[model samples]
Target chain A: MRIGDLAARTGVSVRSLRYYEEQGLLDSSRSPGGHRHYDEEGVDRVAYLQRLYAAGLSSQTILSLLPCLESPSAATSDSAFDRLVEERDKLVTHIAGLTRTLESLDELITLNRKRRAASVADPDSGEPGRTTQG
Target chain B: MRIGDLAARTGVSVRSLRYYEEQGLLDSSRSPGGHRHYDEEGVDRVAYLQRLYAAGLSSQTILSLLPCLESPSAATSDSAFDRLVEERDKLVTHIAGLTRTLESLDELITLNRKRRAASVADPDSGEPGRTTQG
Candidate 1:
């Protein structure tokens, strides 16, 4: 597939795909006519890259991790797998914190919506005054 | 408290605190001695900024969200709060996805560790030969 197909499949922009290639996070083969072509595995690889980026991993870090992901044997040596485990643990903790914060934000939104509905219905004299509604 | 103190309290580097100030995500008053002074609220604000960054939000996005957090009234107008609520929802979804990936990585690490231990104990044979452990 071409870059456009990869972009469409991965939901990443063409510019970002090119940038990822430049950053060594992705690679494509050159055709005889100078066109770039990606294999079927490219879709999964791009998806993984997107997940890593969304998880706040820098492109350089993702690039380094990609080789380990592709070859587990290479990853297991020299405690590389250990480092990956540690990084994943930290990511899990961070995700949990974000989840809690998100829940609090959702509760705040629900409360705010209820208050808005109450104010709209009454239009006056509810809680203190309209000046301090928020 | 000074910027350095806020940095220490929030676990954010002083340079990043200044960068956050430049990005308008943080605000501090200047004393007569030309030093920046932050209130107790600054610690919480900086902590929130660090979390937002870790959650993959850009400094600009955090900056826009900060004003809404500081003044809920201003946030309520034109559905500004609604946008924040939606963004938070997306963040929650992203965090959940990351959590799942992290768990999968943990399982992979555990399996790899067990396989390694078995390989080391026997130095051969286990699961259809040791040619493919990973």
Candidate 2:
């Protein structure tokens, strides 16, 4: 399939497909007309790349772990295995930070809700917002 | 204090601090020599910015939501309030995706561990990794 076809199937932009190719995170072959072509497995490969990218793995790190990611076993090189463990630990830390940020957002949301409720009760918004038991 | 002081205090790089200023997420004043300076509140503001960035907010989104981030109240502009809610939803989605990736990594780790254990038991590893007993 053409690059555009892969992009459409995966919902990833063609530009990003090109970037993944540039970063060596993806592969393609040139057609007779010099257009990029991908095999049927390209769909699954693109999705896998997206998952790793979403996991916050840098291209270099992803490249190192590619062998393990594509095929998991005890036969994976010691360095690749170590990289997998390290990346996993980093994900844990990032998730914790994001969770804290979510908590802060929730607090802000709650504060806003309470203030709105107070304003409604007091009619301090100045437009007679109160409804008489409607 | 200078940019370096804020960086040292927060452990964020000076370049990142400058980027935050350019993004309007951090405030600074210039002295007669045109050196950027931050006041005591700079420390807290940098930390706050770090939290927001960790939550995966883009600079533009952070800029729009700054008024509320600096001080949350019922009086925040309607647009900023809406942005705050929108950002919260995005964070939820991102956290969910990261959680899935973490699970995938855990599965890969378990697969490798199982492979290693099986290799040891079968002795096909050919190295006699197992001990007879102490």
Candidate 3:
């Protein structure tokens, strides 16, 4: 498919696709008319790239780690696999932290809802203030 | 506390704290001697800002949403709180996707470890290829 098709399929802008190619995070072949063409694999590859970027991994780190993600069974050294495991551990820690944040948000939202309800029930009670959570 | 102290307390770089202030995602007061001073509230504020950044929220979006996060019970219009809930919902979706990726990585790691153990047991089984998982 052409660049436009890839962009439409992935929901990424054409400029970002080109930037990914330039950063070596993606690849394309030129057509007979010199337009960029991406194969079917490009779809999943772009999706993976987007996930890593969303996780706050730099393009450089993602580029370095792509091999571990792309090839699961090609004979890599134990140390290489170890590094990938380390990266995974980092992700685990990150996920845990985000989970905590989500919980905090949930608590705050619940408290606000209750307060809002009370205020609605009794308009003369003065405005309910922000919940002070440490 | 001073900028450096805040950086130390929050584990964020002093430069990044300055950047956050410049982006309007954080605020600091200046002492009479012209040095930036941050209050106790700045600690949690910086931590929250960092988490938002890690979750891929741009500074602009975070700046706009700060009020919702900072004040849970202050009388915000229904629309304002609705926008915050929308953002939280987005984070929930992102967390779900990352969980899937983490699971995928776990499977790949397990497969690779099994393959490595098998190769160790029999050096002449011909190279085991990647597990073809769709």
Candidate 4:
């Protein structure tokens, strides 16, 4: 398949796939016309890279951890082990912060939604203050 | 409290606090000596801003959502409601991806730790291959 196809399947941008290729995180071959081509494995690899990037992992960190990710049961490099654990801890803290943010946003959203619902149900009072809140 | 004190209390930079003030997300008063001052409310406001930033909310998006955040029972603007829901959905998807990444990193870390532990227990074979696997 083509690079664009892989990007479509993974829901990642073509530019990002190219960036991953540049970072040595993704593999692609050249077609007869010199366009990039990928296989099914490339799709899974791009998805994995996307997750790591989503966790705010630097390309360098992902590179360090790739060995262990690829061969999980094999003897792993010390650097990879250390990076993995460090990233995991950082991610835990980040997730906690984001969860709190989500909760706060949820509260605000719920409050607004409830207000809209209540006002919409009271047509007499709502008619005067109508303003596309729903 | 002084701006520096607020920074210290909130674990945020004076520059960031000033930016938040500029964005109207935070409030501060200038003293006779031309120093910015804040109260306990500043601390909480900074914390809230930090959480929103952590969840990848832009200053503009936060500005749009601030009305309901400040006065939960007040009628929310339509723009605020829309932006809040949009940002909430984005954060939800982002958190899911990061959680998956964290789990993957955990698996890799555990695999490497097990390999190291196993190699160390078999020191007769490990001594010859010892190279900081732990």
Candidate 5:
């Protein structure tokens, strides 16, 4: 498949695909006409790259882990396992932070709902806000 | 306060602070000698910007939503609320995606652990892998 088709299939931009190739996370052989050609497994490889990128791994880190992930049957080094554990820990932290943000957003949404409800309930009182005049 | 001080206090890089200023998410004044200067309130504003960025809102979206977040007591337009709701939905999606990734990572870790345990249990059998020879 051509690079364009791979990009279209993966929903990743051509520029990003090129960057992934440059970063050594992806590979594409050049055809006789010098056009980039991807193998049949390119789609799965791109998807895997997307997952690792989405998990907040840097290109460098992904480059290191890509081989290990691709060949799960192969004996993985302790360092690779450590890096995976580190990445898992980072994901845990990101999830926790996002959960806190979600909680705050929920509180804000609830507050807004109550304020809107108050506005509807007391149309005469232009100021039915929670903040009391000090 | 100088940009360095703000960077140190906020834990955001000086380069990023400048980028945020360029993106209109932050503001700073230049001194007589042309050094960047931040007010006392700049710290809080930068922290707020950090939270929004961490929530995965782009700088453009942050610029639009910053005013409403800064003034929660003031009247927020319906569109602002809609944008906030949209951002909240995005955050939810991101959290869900990360959660799924975390589950996969956990599974990989478990599989690796099991492989290691099996290898220990069967020292004579060089091939303790899950993959069966076809």
Candidate 6:
């Protein structure tokens, strides 16, 4: 398909598609007229890349892993699969850490808002020089 | 304090501190000896910036929000606080979405691993030619 059609089908901007290609996350062959052409499998590839990215994997990591999915030799090798499992486990742990930190940030934001509201309501009660003094 | 002390105290690398300064997330004044000097409050500021970055906020967003914490006018203004609250809410939503996606990817990886393991164990049973197949 052409770039415009691929962008519309994937719901990704053409610029991002180009960027992904530049990052080696996507590929397109040139036609006889020098225009880009992508096969139907490109859609699935793009979707997989998007999923990896959303999971906080870097473009470089995704590019490296793409070969494991594409090459039958690597896909069928027990050791390769084992390595993939280990990498995925690390990714899960990393995501868990990020999730915990995100929750803490949410709590901090909530507390900050509450403190600000209280300070606004009671100018002289909480923390001298912090109410009308700051 | 100098950059090295600040890095030692914060547990951040000196290179990252310099990068943060280049990204406008940190500031340092020069001493008479041509060395960078930071006030005590710089520690808290760096910590805050780290927290924001860990929360998945971009350096640019953190830099923009830094002024709110530093300037009494913006910090105390109800409108500015409201904007901050809104931005924080958006950030929370974004983090939640990413967390959900991460969880889904974890499940997908688990399923893939299980399928691969079963295929490896039974070379002739599952899915014609898929056992010993690619």
Q: Highest DockQ, which number?
A: 3
> What is the lDDT ranking, best to worst?
2, 3, 4, 5, 1, 6
Q: By DockQ thresholds, what CAPRI class is model 4? A: acceptable
**Where does candidate 5 stray beyond 4 Å?**
A29-31, A121-134, B1-9, B13-46, B121-134
Each model's DockQ score:
0.28, 0.27, 0.42, 0.33, 0.25, 0.26
How do the residues A44-65 of candidate 3 rate in per-residue lDDT, one tens digit apiece? 8888788777666788877766
Q: Highest lDDT, which number?
A: 2
> Candidate 6's interface RMSD, please?
7.3
Which lDDT tens digits does candidate 6 get at residues A74-101? 1445554555566677666765666665
Q: Is candidate 2 or candidate 6 better by DockQ?
A: 2
lDDT of 4 by residue, A18-93 (tens): 9988887887889888999987888778877877777888898888877667665336667776777887899999
Candidate 2 DockQ, CA atoms: 0.27
At residue A103, candidate 6 shows an lDDT of 62
TM-score of each: 0.77, 0.82, 0.83, 0.81, 0.75, 0.68
lDDT of each: 0.69, 0.78, 0.76, 0.75, 0.74, 0.64
TM-score-wise, the better of 5 and 6 is: 5
Per-residue lDDT of B1-134 in model 3, one digit per residue for the tens?
99999999999999999999899888889999989999898898888788777766788877666555666554655766776677778889988878877787787788777767777787755445643221
Worst window of 10 by summed lDDT in candidate 1 chain A: A125-134
Model 2 CA RMSD to the hidden true structure, in angstroms? 7.6
lDDT of 2 by residue, B1-134 (tens): 99899899999999999998888777799999999999988887778778887787889988998756654545567799889899999999999988988988887777666666776677555332321110
Whole-model alpha-carbon lDDT for candidate 1: 0.69
The alpha-carbon deviation from the true structure for residue A114 of candidate 5, after best TM-score superposition, in angstroms, is 2.5
Write the residue-wise lDDT of candidate 5 on A1-134 in tens digits.
99999999999999999999999988889999989999878887887678778878899998776544654432666677678778889999988988887777766666665665666666544433441101
Index of the highest-TM-score prediction: 3
Candidate 5, residues B1-134, lDDT tens digits: the string is 99999999999999999999999877789999988999888887787677777878799997776544544432656677678778889889889888887887777776666665666776544433442100
Model 3 residue A34 CA deviation in Å: 3.6
